[model samples]
Target: MVDAKDLSLAPRLLPISLSVEAGQVVHLIGPNGSGKSTLLELLSGLEVPQSGSVWLQGQPVSGQTRYDLAQVRGYLMQQQRPAFVMVVFEYLNLVLDSVQLATGEIRDKAVADVVSRLAISDKLHRRIDSLSGGEWQRVRLAGVLLQVSKALNPHACLLLLDEPSTGLDVAQQAVIYQEITALAREQEIAIIMANHDLNRTLEHADTVVVLQQGRIVSLGPPKAVLTDRLLSDVFATPLEQVSTANGPVIMRASSS
Candidate 1:
């Protein structure tokens, strides 16, 4: 549903090309300054690349097409700052207000579904400024999801998230990832997320794109691309992949 061809943004992002199809969860994994955020911005049409092109749903992603693209794509940046002090429900209502919903019932159902999935039902009455880091992140995410939900935008086909699990604890992270995977599968939406946790990517991502110094080192299924040798070289550390009952885990290679 989304295609980026030879995308480049000066020194930060090098030539990159990739495509995301419906019901696919593509993860971008790399260390600091590897251009994960740059790539996402390019795909979201938040920033135009110096070279190459990004297309969403077959339309070129430029300032001219952003208005139409906005209806079908949801993007959550790594950092979010609340613009004003408002109740969680109020903030969410404002997001839904932008979309053309069928009726009050439809709006209510959309809000309920996103809040429940993000586990922020209890925070509806709370002020945005009063929530903890994790709570705030979930609220931000809920807003994005609600804006592009099928009830609001039946044409919704793409979701771009950057470090979505920023401040959440382990349990919360697990819940969020599960919800994310379900969203992609059930809604048939193509998802591209920049994540730091290799194990989490392995568990949830249908495909993995490993980056290093602003270029793609490897791209494929997590188990195939995230091998011990590749990760060790890309991360510039001694790392190993171990087999466990749960799944394959990436860890620092023990020095003995």
Candidate 2:
């Protein structure tokens, strides 16, 4: 469990007191600059909160080395530009080889499987900078996957992705979400992803937390909370919506 007891990050996130349970897939949905990433950063301890405490699994999560916290959680920020200029596979290897695995072949095979699932198998030899934005995002996500798998046991991983679906096409986006769903179900990892894909996020999420102006506007089950009024109020725009055969689809109205 991640608890934010009156957490505050100045000039960024408004003070918030929120608690998210384990095995819950929650999406912090908000418009750009609505403190989604700031909330994430504060929770992940990338930025120190101005006030309050963060408790992970009932223990205070701060006052420790960043490397120590990495063991309990894995955070993927909004952007991960290539600073090292390494091959994609090498990066995967770097993440994969960090943990002490009993079998070399098994480790390599697992890394390969993760790369395949993220749809970056063909780009294994390509340098990160040489690939497109979406491809690099996948590679970085794959590295995250590998890192988490390598370090964490089942039922004890927190995957916090800030705007994960940003650069992907529809198919790629689906794959990314599917991967998240599988992790939550199969590995029992807690997932908190931020995205603008309201429909997809709602469909995949167990719960949705709506934020506006750094404040949590609403929090509940997706179907109950994703109403037109909530959408319009949180986004500060008139969002047209419909409950279709599938699920709630939020649309934008164009002035005609």
Q: Highest TM-score among the candidates is held by which one?
A: 1
* lDDT digits (tens) for residues 230-250 of candidate 2: 898878888766767875677
- Candidate with top lDDT is 1
Q: What tens-digit string does per-residue lDDT give for candidate 1 at 136-197?
A: 99998898887667767898889999999999999889888987888888888889999999
Model 1 segments beyond 4 Å from truth? Answer: none
The backbone clash count of each candidate, in order, is 0, 0
Clashes of 2: 0
Candidate 2 regions exceeding 4 Å error are 97-103, 150-156, 253-256
The residue pairs in collision within model 2 are: none
CA RMSD per model (angstroms): 1.3, 2.1
**Candidate lDDT (C-alpha), each:** 0.87, 0.79
